[model samples]
Target: MQKKLVLGTAVAAVLAAGTFGAVSANASAPAAAPAAVVKADAGSDNLFRTNHLTIDAATDAAEAVLDAAEKENQRVSVAVVDRNGNTLVTLRGDGAGPQSYESAVKKAFTAVSWNAP
Candidate 1:
């Protein structure tokens, strides 16, 4: 009974030591990758860029351009777009009809895409 108790204690001590050693080793291991570590940006869908446009600015520019059209009594849609072919803002004159908004945006996108005046 004494020998068995001693042997059991030795086995338990060995297991406890091994567990402590393993925990100490793991604690001293090198840290994992940092939270702020930057990785290579993949694919073409980059989210870092922005195109700015204002309703006021686009409205002013477009109004000036469309003034002549309106003066000539033409019911045409005018579109305005930013430098990246994105629609900024649009204005449809009185009697310009329902599809005017679509036409204006399309024209603006086309103009900006092709870099037209």
Candidate 2:
């Protein structure tokens, strides 16, 4: 019985030592370096990048509409949106109702959706 107990203890100690050695080796191992990121140049052929409207152009369009409305003596709100339904400019004329703002936004979104002028 004494011999068997000694043999079992020796086996357990060997297994524990092996586990500790493996953990220590892993802890000392150097980590791999991160991959470098590549930047795209202006001449690069990137399919993800496409034409987009500039804020200046959108504001000009909204101003043109406001000019027309002013000439007609109309108190209204104007909203210019992009292809993605993002409002680039929103203008409310003098004495324009609060609901006119929401109406103008909806109109701009609808025009973008339908590709209307």
Candidate 3:
């Protein structure tokens, strides 16, 4: 029993020593610096960061479309998309057809694809 106790204590002490050495080695190493940020110029190939419309502008465009529909005495849905063809605003006028929502989004996406106003 005494021999077994001594053997267990010796194994534990060796493992503890190894863990302490590894921790100290890692602690002494220098940390890596953060990556630097680079800004893209107007003619740069970073297209994703360019030609983005703010939420307010997108919403205004959508409202303008809705107002036009109102003047024509028609209920409709209007969608405004960013340069990336992602819908930023979708407005469904009162009594508009259920499918009008999808139609408006598709129209917005088509305009973006064709680079039209």
Error of 2 at 13 (Å): 81
Per-residue lDDT tens digits of candidate 2, residues 1-20? 32332222222211111110
Question: How many times do residue backbones clash in model 3?
Answer: 0
> How do the residues 24-100 of candidate 1 rate in per-residue lDDT, one tens digit apiece?
11011012211122334666576353324345544544454445445656454455554565654455656666766
Model 1 TM = 0.47
Instruction: Report the C-alpha lDDT of model 3 over 3-91, residue by residue, as the tens digit.
Output: 33222222221111111011111011011211123347868786433233445545544555555556656667666565567776777
Q: For model 3, what is the error of residue 53's alpha carbon versus the real structure, in angstroms, after optimal superposition?
A: 0.8
User: Which prediction has the highest TM-score against the true structure?
Assistant: 2
- C-alpha TM-score for every candidate: 0.47, 0.57, 0.55
Cα-based lDDT for every prediction: 0.40, 0.46, 0.46
Which wins on lDDT, candidate 1 or candidate 3? 3
Candidate 1 yields a Cα-based lDDT of 0.40
Off by over 4 Å in 1: 1-54
41, model 3: CA deviation in Å?
A: 11
The segments of candidate 2 whose C-alpha lies over 4 angstroms from its true place after superposition are 1-49
